[model samples]
Target: MKTTIAYLATATALVALATAAQAQDKKTLAIVVKGLDNPFFEQINLGCQKWMSENADSEYQCLYTGPASSADEAGEVQIVDDLLTSGVAAIAISPSNAPAMANRVREIAPDVPVMTIDADFLEADRDLRTTYLGTDNYLMGVKMAEEAAKLKPEGGTVCLQLGNVAADNINARAQGFRDTAGGAEGIERLAGEGGWTEIEGCPVFTNDQADLANQQMADTFIANPDLDAFILVGGWAQFAPQAYSQVTDQVMDKLNSKELIIIAGDTLPPQTQAFRDGRSHAQVGQRPFEMGYKAPDVMIQLIEGQTVEDPLYTGLDVCNQDDPGFCKDN
Candidate 1:
């Protein structure tokens, strides 16, 4: 009877191990970005999917979903909800609006681990997420300003194109630029026809909007033809050299010269090309692919009883034409 009981116990243990293996094998991870249309996010999603497939023993699935348009927060919320309902074990998101989405996110998937990448849910509850993996927006701003200072050692009026006013991450980057530029002696941030807000710089389908904003930039250039530098909170300002070239002869002339200093955030392929073509001086490389590859690896660690930390900033870089790793080596 003792031998029979021992045999029964061993079978039970084997069954438990099999069950656990099946559970791990069936788990899925969902990634939701701000928008699927953005090529930057596309690269990130691709990296995540690659990691999931390569690490198949983890039994993880990667699902990527986003809004149709960059501004579609409601669509993002719905996607998050759907992912939760689909029984994902983990989720990583680039939040669209932290304040509005926090409560909903917590309510829908209270136990599943959630993370933010590239951007964060700043207004969410302290415990609302398992981790935030991306660049520190404030530091990125300071870097941009430092580059700005290098361009005009004497300092001059700098026009900032702040993008996505609804995004706290972008706003923090903008605020960082504002704070740093103010402290730099001789750097004067213009007002009225001077600095453009995110709402003002937000892109629309209209080419006229681009033309109008370019005219506004030209008008500012007219007032201070000496406007020697520009700091974009993101990639928005990178477009200025082209638009301003068409609108003002002065800007056209300086497009290829050292007269204009352009610095921005997030070095994407197009942005890298833009820099190579002399449209932007430097870019803060957020390293989206690294972030993508790391997120699942961290989640796997969590499943294996390893503790994951909050606010894990994967990697960051400053890139220009000469930097060997500025863009993809390819």
Candidate 2:
């Protein structure tokens, strides 16, 4: 009995050592987003998983992880810090708060390759990341503004909806919209420039909460009944299809008559359906799946000391009710 117990303990120790060795042999390529709850991020996660499955023979393993809540900026930073020391070979982050993430990245000064996906750091802090792989956010905003202009030739009162206040991508999109719609570069807000004026209590920040986003829209409409257009720099409200449908339903007549133009970001399934249902006018989408799919390869290249583009753009998809071909199948 004593001999058998000793033998079993030895076997367990050997197994544990083998498991540790196997784990160390495989390097992790992690893609960290703002939150896992958001479907937009989920699409990216799917693409990461696809890459992992296809490259099963490779020494690298892909990991998709993030905070439980999109609003948890600290959580995202903490995850990045943990991953930096946790045997991750490479990391691609979609920063929840640009400046905060930049600070963390700068502090860690990680030895491994680091890249930014979806949201990027502020321009001054761009050097912190090896590359940026995502949409040309400014151009997306410009496109959205163009769509709004097409619907309302002579610009009028408008409200801009955005995600996290400190997110660089969201800020870039806002800048693009303001610059285009106001007909001047670096125009912060439209007072009377280019016949456009942001309504009082305008440019509402949602903090990436779908419910709050929808409520803000409804409240804005109630307060400013004569508002001409509503622009969403991120698809916050529309992510919750049911709530969005209910809110937009109230203004269906205005949408149909083109009295209230609504142009939002991202052409997700539900957002596309919203366009079909006449809840929104146009959608300027970012290719998040493409970003996820390409991230692992890009990281591998970086790790191998191969040259890659600094800002590897994934491009955009423009969808509108008038342009059926542009819209994706729901």
Candidate 3:
């Protein structure tokens, strides 16, 4: 009886050791976004999952996580801090608050490879991350403004809608739009530059709240009946399809008449549908899937001590009612 018991105990010990070894063999490549609530990030998550699926035999596994709400900048920062100590082999972050994120990243000074996806740290603090993998946000804004210029050459009263006030990517896009449409670099507000004037109380900040974004648009139109163009540097309002549709419905007549040109960033399905429905004028989209798909490979390269390009651009997609072929269900 004693001999049998010893044999069983030794077998269990060996099994436990083997399981621990297996667990240690598998390293985690984590992608943390601003929020899990946004479908845009969900697309990124799907792409990350695709990479994991295609590399099922690999020892590295991809983990996708984020704050429950995009507005939770502190929550996102805390998550990054937690993941840094959680044995992740590498981390890819889409910062919700550029400055705050950079501060935290600097504090932690994580030993693992860190890169920014979708959004990046402000230029001053860019060294916090190894590289950025996402859209050329400035060019995206320039393209949107160019489309608006094409539709309304004389440039009229315009309003720019943006995401978080401190988000680096959104700021870059906003600056690009202002520079292109206003025809003057570094102009804060369009005061008749390039025949464009940004109305008072314009350039509303949404903080990534879809409902609030929709309300802000409605209020802007109500306030400025002569508002000529509305530019969204991010897809906050359009993410809430129903609310956005309703808000745009109130301005359909203007949209149809081309009196109010609404050019937005991101070509999400709902935004595309809005264009098809003649609610918005055009969409300038970033390749979120490509960002997610390519991030893992970049992380792997970093892990292997291989040099990768900084600020790797995924590319953009522009579509309009006249050019429907450019927009597809992403």
Candidate 4:
């Protein structure tokens, strides 16, 4: 009877392993971003689909998801938990809050690979992720500063407009701006413009809220007429049709005439259209599609026993009015 029981247990163990292998073959990848309301994340979603179609031999599938905005840190964490429960082979997250997600990433790292794209965790929790696939955020900041300096060589007051000031990537970009164009070369930052709440030079969160972004933008331009330029580190306003109307009516002409310069991040259709129509000046375009495209490739690489030699950072292409090809193609 003991021999019979042992044989039955061994057979059951083999069957369980076979079942787990089958599940892995059918496992889906979750590409989670900060929010879904924006086109950057949509490009990421498209990129994933495109890649999967091209790599049919890999047999990998992906699901793109996000919360309402970049401010929803808890919502983002919950998405990760949900993906974990759903049995994803791997997870690629563009966290709204890196430090906040560190523990969660750490908790699941042993079971499956967890990597970061776009924004990354603080140094202490950096190892929680299997790899980081995005730009050197600080370099992106430096690039923005260089472009701003190039545009307004005469130097004037500039203010920052962005989302989620608490993010590490946001702070890194802000610091990069400080290091690159923190008013050292005669350009003054609009210090506490009109006594609005200031955190890393961004008074209003915008929360990716079009109306609020437009309102804050109009107020900033109207409040400080001589405000010279805007460095939208996380360019949230340009997404909405109604967004920046007042700024366009009142301030965009300055941009068109080269009197006022606006440099934004993330190039989407809205950005392309605005640049074409002279609503905004230039975009320090972060390729969300490319980031999205690489995300699945990276995850599949790990899933299939391939190695990541480097972080696989995306390029920051600056699409001014002169070149909207990238925008149109995207």
Tell me how many residue pairs clash in candidate 1.
0
Per-candidate count of clashing residue pairs (backbone under 3 Å): 0, 0, 0, 0
Predictions ranked by TM-score, top down?
Answer: 2, 3, 4, 1
User: 64-88, model 1: which lDDT tens digit per residue?
Assistant: 6666545566666766776677466
TM-score, every prediction: 0.75, 0.92, 0.92, 0.81
Query: lDDT of each model, Cα atoms only?
Result: 0.63, 0.87, 0.86, 0.70
Tens-place lDDT digits, model 4, residues 181-271: 6544322343433221123444456665566777777878777776677777877778775666556778766887777787777777777
What's model 3's overall lDDT?
Answer: 0.86
Kindly state the number of residue pairs that clash in model 2.
0
- Deviation in angstroms for 137 in model 2? 0.3
* Model 4 poorest 10 in a row by lDDT: 192-201
The model with the greatest lDDT is: 2
Model 3 C-alpha lDDT per residue in residues 96-166, reported as the tens digit of each score: 99899889889988999999999989999988788999999999989988999999999999999998888
Alpha carbon lDDT at 94, candidate 3: 95
**In angstroms, how far off is 267's CA in candidate 3?**
1.0
How do the residues 52-111 of candidate 2 rate in per-residue lDDT, one tens digit apiece?
789988998777887777877877887788778655779999999999999988998999
lDDT for predicted candidate 1 compared with the true structure: 0.63
Which residue window of length 10 is worst by lDDT in model 2? Answer: 2-11
